[model samples]
Target: MMIILKSKKRQPHQTEKTIQILKDKLRERKIKSKIIVLENIEVFLNEKRVVMKINNWIPSKRSPVYFRIAERYKNASYIFSKYLEMKKVPFIDNYHTFTRERNKLIQMFLLAIKGISIPKTYYSPAYDSRKIRNAARFLKFPVVIKLTEKERGEGVFLAKNAVEIKRILGKNKGQEIILQEYLDNDFDYRILVLGHKTKLGETRTRTNKREFRNNACVGAVEEFFPAEEVPSDMKKISEQSSRIMNIQVCGVDIIRSRKGKIYVIEVNFSPGFTLDEKMDELNQTADYLKKWHEKKY
Candidate 1:
């Protein structure tokens, strides 16, 4: 069976490496695969029929494809996924699940409603000062302001007071921001879940002493740990979060407060992988897809 990896034209260094690793693993299994950059994709509908061509080549309808598009191109991804579904092509993470999981606010709302522990979050697109002040009052000082559409800790800010909050809001005018209760933790865990199973667990700690966000893109270091070393509760919750999001593969970021309460910070549908752990994740993903292809075809 053919495997297609869809991603942006300009992917980060790590993302490019991860894609190469996945391609290699699939090749080892003798599965035909190719990478399709979304920038080169064109979709057209004529005579009540959908037509999709990637770099002037139409993908086979029988192949299973995986999307690696980032949040910015989510709308395109949604449209492409819908076309694939209409053509009865197999793909990982449908459009609905992909779009919903990309929104941090929506993830927290859905997970919180299901009794999953999440940091208290408030969002407003209008940037109303009264609502901002109310969020400050409800969540208290030292709140976290996160841009709803960003990833890799790009637009995360810590506000110690209303003045700082106002300043941030002013600077980010017209942007949707979510105010979350800041949980003071030294480090957080990034648990990779695939096929409803916890495959790999890692601890992300900020290498910069002053940095509160522990993202590898921003000077954070990641170290792989055995699955058994992770807390049972964390593992269970990570798996549950992925399932609830209707995602087959994801990275669940969980943090533990000083009081030992576990709170899920975020769930990443397209989680980054380090050089050391890339092979393991790709191998498992390939095996799972192979099995899926066997069962379906």
Candidate 2:
């Protein structure tokens, strides 16, 4: 089996560790796989040649790319989708699906249209004070300002009002942003759904007062929940969200408010399982990928 990792040329320590662990697990499973650690394989894609070195076997095939994003996801799936279409190759999380899932604004739009209960949100390309002022007036107070196309909560902010937004936007200019209604929840849960199976669902809570964000990267504590503990409607919503977004593997962020109401926060197309604190997540993800490859090729 040929596997590729679209990661940074200079990866972070966590990223490197995750890749190492995945490779180790695959080896233990006796799965023949290759990790192509490069992002823009445009030359390889165009020439239809990826010289993969797996063990002593230098198998060469003009096989089309059947993969997901490894680096910045902007236009990642879009470009790959074009290649898939040209080669008539079946792949998971194509461009259209990736684009929609990557952008919080797009996910909100689709979910809202489907009558899903997502927090009220607003997105605007203009970061000028006037627009920020208008957005504050339109959206709920203590809303979130997010960079439209970034991951790991890299560009997310909790804005108290137009004043805070102006201060932040003034320092950084000419960047597209999204203002979302903040549902005041103490902790957030990231639910993983792969193909037709729910691999794992866990809650991430901020362990320190300094870190307000509950993302696992921000030193949040992760704890697993039993399948029976998963809210029934949430299960249905998560499943529908994946199918509607046309992704084989997905991550959905659901907010459980202080008052015990659940709101679908966002959907992730190329959701990452490699760096999960729990190794089971990584192993199961790798195993699922093995199963998928077995079925596909």
Best by TM-score: 1
Cα deviation in Å at residue 285, candidate 2?
A: 1.6
- Residue-pair clashes per candidate: 0, 2
In candidate 1, what are the lDDT values of residues 1-297, reduced to their tens digit? 565555554667987888889889989998878776775554332122334566456666778888776776565566567656766788888653445445776666557656688887765334456666767766788999888779989999999998899999899975756788899999999998888788778889997888999998998888877677888999899999998888888889999999998889999998876756356656656777788789899
State each model's C-alpha RMSD to the native: 17.0, 17.4
Please list the residue runs of candidate 2 whose C-alpha ends up more than 4 Å from where it truly belongs after superposition.
1-101, 128-130, 226-228, 274-278
Native-structure RMSD, model 1: 17.0
lDDT of 2 by residue, 113-218 (tens): 5667777665433344555555566565887777766788688888787778787777666555667677776789877877855667888888888666788777
Q: Report model 1's TM-score to 2 decimal places.
A: 0.64
